[model samples]
Target: MAWSRDEIARRIASDIPDGWTVNIGVGIPTLVPRYIPQGREVVFHSENGILGMVPLREDESPDPEVIDAGKNAVSIRFGGSFFDSSVSFAMIRGGHIDLGIVGALQVSQNGDLSNWSTNERMIGGIGGAADVCSGVKQLWVAMMHTAENGTRKLLTDCTFPLTAVSVVCRVYSDLAVLERDERKWKVVTLSPGTDLLEVRNATGFPIDI
Candidate 1:
């Protein structure tokens, strides 16, 4: 059984420390704000220039100007502040963000990330990923274990253009949670119905259980 996108978001939320300023990247990472555990206060920093983001409301009309890096309309907490993109990137590059949650195309055992584009075509601009990866104190990736074509994404080397090298500290996929140390990748947790053997088979590189 594969973890749903919400489940992956929930898993990632559990790992985020309370009181930390977090920058949620586009895609699955944007879902993380909704799953943050109760009793914890996390200040969400959007690359598009909003901080203290709350969950987006469906019933309520959205504010066009209030959006995340993905351009998805969002709500903010009581004390939220808005600024220009330059100020936002400054916050990211200044090393003020504690954690950065990003979606990745591929990650190597050595913690390299390649989420920007594929070799076949350019999907979109790299955006602030390069800065977020290098600026945050810790970087966590949330993505599918395999591509739509069933190609393994956790590999010995990323075929896509590198976004940041040796920057990923952890990965949360539908199949498993992996952590990287200086030398190797380790399986921290496996999704329900998945075993060490299954994870090993899916990944292109070896992972310690």
Candidate 2:
């Protein structure tokens, strides 16, 4: 069976080092905080100046002022703080973030990222992606393995405009966990019932198991 969005987030959460500060990009990556391992200390950072973001409780009313970078209502953990975007960006650009988990439209075997836009139209204006990709010690992509048309998103070369080159260290897709070593892409884990052959056939690029 393929992993669900929440399962993918859990998988990514398991790989994050304890005590690391992580910037959770919008979309699927935003779900990561809910699945982080118990007893572990991980600080969630938002590009919009939120630090230590936690999941909102169902019974509690959401504060309109407390939101993540995606503008979704959220809660804050103990010691969480808020600041201006400039300060938020400084944390992102100054290499203070330990890990960055982001979504992608396409990722090349060479670790090229193209997530922000397709064609010439700007989608969401590439908010903080460039800085996050470059500033984090490790960058991981969390997204579906294929496009809506069933076209493989893991490719030999990205057709979309590149957001950053060779910055992706790992990818946690619904089907597998892939890592880039130098110039080679390898499958480090597979979803239940998925095999190396399936992964090879699903990807547009050659992959080592």
Report, for every candidate in turn, its global Cα lDDT versus the true structure. Answer: 0.91, 0.91
1-209 per-residue lDDT for model 2 (tens digits): 98999999999999988999999998899889989889999999998888899999898799999988898999988999999999998998898999999999999988999999988777888788989998888999999999889998888899999889999999898889999997888888999998888888889988876
lDDT of 1 by residue, 28-53 (tens): 99889989999999999998898898
As for model 1, its CA RMSD to the true structure in angstroms is 1.1
Clashing pairs for model 2 are none
Q: TM-score for candidate 1, please give it.
A: 0.96
Clashes of each: 0, 0
Q: Which residue pairs collide, candidate 1?
A: none
Q: Candidate 2: misplaced stretches above 4 Å?
A: none
**Model 1's lDDT to the true fold?**
0.91
Q: Which sections of candidate 1 miss by over 4 Å?
A: none
